[model samples]
Target: MQLLLIASEVFPFSRTGGLADVMAALPESLVRLGVDVTVLSPWWQSLHGQPTEVWRGSVPHGGRLQPGAVRVGEVRAAGVRYLFLGTPDFERPGLYAEDDVERFLRWGNLVLPTLQSMGLTFDLVHGHDWAAGTVVAHARAAGLRSVYTIHNLQYQGRWNFAEGAAWSGLPAAMLPDAEFYGDLNLMKAGLVFSDHVTTVSPTYAREITTREYGEGLEGVLQARDAAGALTGILNGLDLDRWNPAADPDVLPMTARSGKPANVAALRAEFLLDDAPILSAVSRLVSQKGLDLLVEALPDVTRDWNVVVLGSGDPLLEAALKGWAQHPRVRYVSGMNEALAHRLYAGSDAFCMPSRFEPCGLSQMISMRYGTLPVVRETGGLVDSVPSDVGFRFSGGGAGDLSAALHAARLAWDDRPGWQARVARGMALDFSWEASARRYVDVYRQVLGA
Candidate 1:
């Protein structure tokens, strides 16, 4: 199959979150299955890797033609071709502006014509997130089969209908479907026009078709679910990238022996005394339920040493900042990949008490490192963290999370029980190969193969 994968950002090029990781691992996995894949992404100034310009053309936007070029990335990771859409609009300082409507709309308008100019043909085009949402609409309109995956439903790209219609170059007839409550919704366009829609997790896919988690698109998701066009494929971890066995950030592989050295190293690094380590590596956002962790910290700190690494939202940052003074707690603001790897490798237990997690990768990463995950039973957390590998609690309250941690502490006190759970976590496979096969099945189904 010739598959065109469109995403706003791709790992090793430009990345802000998990979407980039997905674009990297998924395409490679598909290619391993002997499927031909070409990835389309914007060429940001912050993009890594050298790329050679392959095609130059004009794309329609606001009733005029704008110059754009397609560049092929030199990285050439794992047999998947990388194509970047380079235009002056993307040459700005940041990958995205505060209001992304106009910028992404123009880029969306460029897709069909850009493909035509390059003479690139694909059996199917798959798009991810709101940034690539418009590709589904454009591809479907041009008679190409398409699939759109929602990484996060909260970030629907809504804009003024008049301006979006003008810049997007979409016809009046399609506007009704694209518009949500008088605003042009790029996510709605993708959801409506694509042949099939997928969310990050199976539970999340079900959640979005309801009033609580739908983000006001419940009816549309409900119709898609009824028509057998919606799927919830759990996101997978890149085993190669996350393997504790070969990870350079920590000591070489072992499910047991290497863990003690890493734990010792982590203790020395953080000035922590010998205690069962509990860590949370996240973006420090309300969505992640960091506040709940903060609330539960007073209860968990005496029994466990805590490590936190992430940056976002000032209020959440401030909440974690005070914990730095605590002797057993170390709060490092901002993301550090190496530190994160070490944290996962070293920590006895990892916490992700998210109110709503759309297939969290951290829990999977933690499990891959043979660490127990203390997660609320929601979204992918519900799927990945089984009773054997981790601790789970229900409800959004701090009391529930505190109880889960206290339960984890008891298990930690039991050496035999703790080791058994760690071994189980290591044994579980949350691999991309499994997820890719599912995607291939989706592709074949959409193609009527």
Candidate 2:
């Protein structure tokens, strides 16, 4: 099968969240299954390496046309071919902004033409979230099979109605349902036009068909669900990148070879004491339960040392700044891959108290590193972490977060229990093998094979 995967983010190139990790892993897994996979994403200046090729391109669609040709590039990583829609607009540090609508439309218009120029043919075009929704619509209009994966329905690209009409060639009369109050919604376009739709988890699939979690598109999702077009597939983890035993980040072999030297090395780097460390590595956004974690912070710090690594929302940064005076709490307000691995290795426990996680990657990666997770029992958190391997809270509350944290702390107190849980966590197979098979099944279904 020849598959064209379109997403706004991808690992080892561009990363904003778990979507990048998924984009990096899944295509390689598909390729290993003997399928031809190609990825399309925006090229940002913040990207580390040089592209394999660069070319001049022009895109025309919607109401306006970018007649002045722009430069685009291509690269390959992890067995997947990458095509980057490089433009002056993508030179910014951030992937999207107030000016993102125009860029998205330009890329959406160019995607298919770019592939054709490269002499690439695909049996299916799979697009992720709102950024690539218009591409899915174009593919469908061209009589192509498509799969649209809704990573987060909440982030639908909604803007001025005029802008929407200008960005998509779809007539205003055909987009009544796509308009939310006074704005055009990119996610609505995908939900409407794609042949099949998938969210990251089963619970999220059900949740989005409701008024609350639907982000005001419940009726559309309901219609799609009734039509037998909506489904869910839990996101998979790359165990090779997250494994504790084989990880270069976490060393000293094992207890049989040497004491846990990496733990001490990590603590020294973070200026944490020789106590159990509880870490949270995620964006400091409210949806991730940062407020709830803040509520539980005082008690958590009183017992185990806490280290947080993330940057988002001014309010969240201020809250972390307020905790600077705490002797046992250390906060780093940025994303650092090496530092994140250190936290996973040194921390006795990892926390993910998301209010509604679609399919969290942190909990899975932490478990792979033998860092027991204290996650709320929702979405992918429930699917990824086994009960025996980690502690999970049943409901949404500080009470829930605190109780789970306490369980992890208790395990820390009991060395044997902690060791047992660590062993279990390490033993978990989050490899893409099973997820790849499931995706192949979805591909076959799409192809009517």
Candidate 3:
């Protein structure tokens, strides 16, 4: 089956969060399952290499026609075809444009026509997040099967309805479904108009249908769930990218021998003594429950060496900075792929105390690296890590997290048990093959095959 996957960013080409990784891996997995896949993404300036021009077209914007170009590229790692949409609006430095509404509106308007211009036909078009929601809407309106995946509900693209309607070039008749109160919601458009809606995990799928986690779209999500059009498929990890034994960046180690040399290297790197290490690699935002970490720093650092790598939110940065001054604590405020691999390989425990995690890849990566994960019991965290394999806390508070960390530290003291837990986690499969098969099933169901 031919499939078109649309997203704002894709890994190794452009990326900001987990969405890029998902888009990168899922398509490749689908290809391996004998499905023909094509990806559609914006041509961000930061993207490496240039794509060959495939199709040229125009889109409506601000009352006039604006010229648009489509360039075809290939992800060498996945051997999948990807098309880049290029226009003056997409030549910006960052992945997201300052005028996101207008930028994605133009993108949504141009996607279907661009596909037609290239004489490409697909059995299904799957869109990721609010950025590609409008594109899914357009595809569905044109009588094509469409799927929309909500990576994160918190980032719904909402804009003034009147202005959005004008800029989006969507008819006034469709405004009611697209509008939430007085604002135009791109996410709502996707949720309301798409043939099916999916989230990253089953728990998250159920969570978003309620007011607590719905971000004001609970009614819509509940309606979708009632109609049996909502699904919660757990996200998968790219084993090739995350395997500890094969990763060149990480120090050579096996599950049997343990990562002593790497642990020593990490201790030296962080200027810490030989203490049990707890590491975190995540955005320093409230959503990630960094504030809880900050609050529990005093208790956590008293027992274990702490290392954190990430950047986001000024207040959280400041809190992490303060904690970094501690002799047993080290903080690196940016993205580093190599260092991340090293941390995963060397650390005794990994922390992901997210207030709500759709499907956390870090915990999965940590598990693959034979490191125990200490996470809050929410969304995918609860599904991915069993109690015997990792530690989990329930309440979204620092106290609860501190208790869980203490439990992990106690587990660390039991060398045999801890190693057994690590072995179990490593042995568990978080591969994309199963996920790909499920996706194919979804495609078949949508097409009535």
Query: Can you give the lDDT of residue 141 in candidate 1?
Result: 78
lDDT, candidate 3, at 334: 91
Alpha-carbon runs more than 4 Å astray in model 2: 59-68, 171-174, 252-259
Report the Cα RMSD per candidate. Answer: 1.5, 2.3, 1.6
Q: Among all windows of ten consecutive residues in candidate 3, which has the lowest summed lDDT?
A: 59-68
lDDT tens per residue, model 1, 18-88: 99999989999999999999999988878887787766666444245444343333346679889887766
lDDT of 1 at 113: 79
- Against the unseen true structure, what C-alpha lDDT does each candidate score? 0.86, 0.79, 0.86
| Candidate 1 whole-model C-alpha lDDT, 0 to 1 | 0.86
- Winning candidate number (lDDT): 1
Arranged by lDDT, best first: 1, 3, 2
Which residue pairs clash in candidate 1? Answer: none
Candidate 3, 201: how far from true, in Å? 0.9
lDDT of 3 by residue, 1-449 (tens): 99999999988788888999998899999999999899989877778777766666653332354543444444445568988877667776777756887778876877777667667888899999999878877776788998889999999888888888876766667778999989989999999988889999889999999888999999999999999999999999988888777789987667776577878888888888778999999988878997888899989987799999999898888888887889988889999999999899889999999999988899999998888999999999988999999999999889999999999999899999998998899889999998888878888888889
What TM-score against the true fold does each predicted structure earn? 0.97, 0.93, 0.96
Q: Residue-wise lDDT of candidate 2 within 207-312, one digit each (tens)?
A: 7888867878889899989998888888888867776667776673332322257667777877877778788999988789977888888777767888889999
Sort the predicted structures by TM-score, highest score first.
1, 3, 2
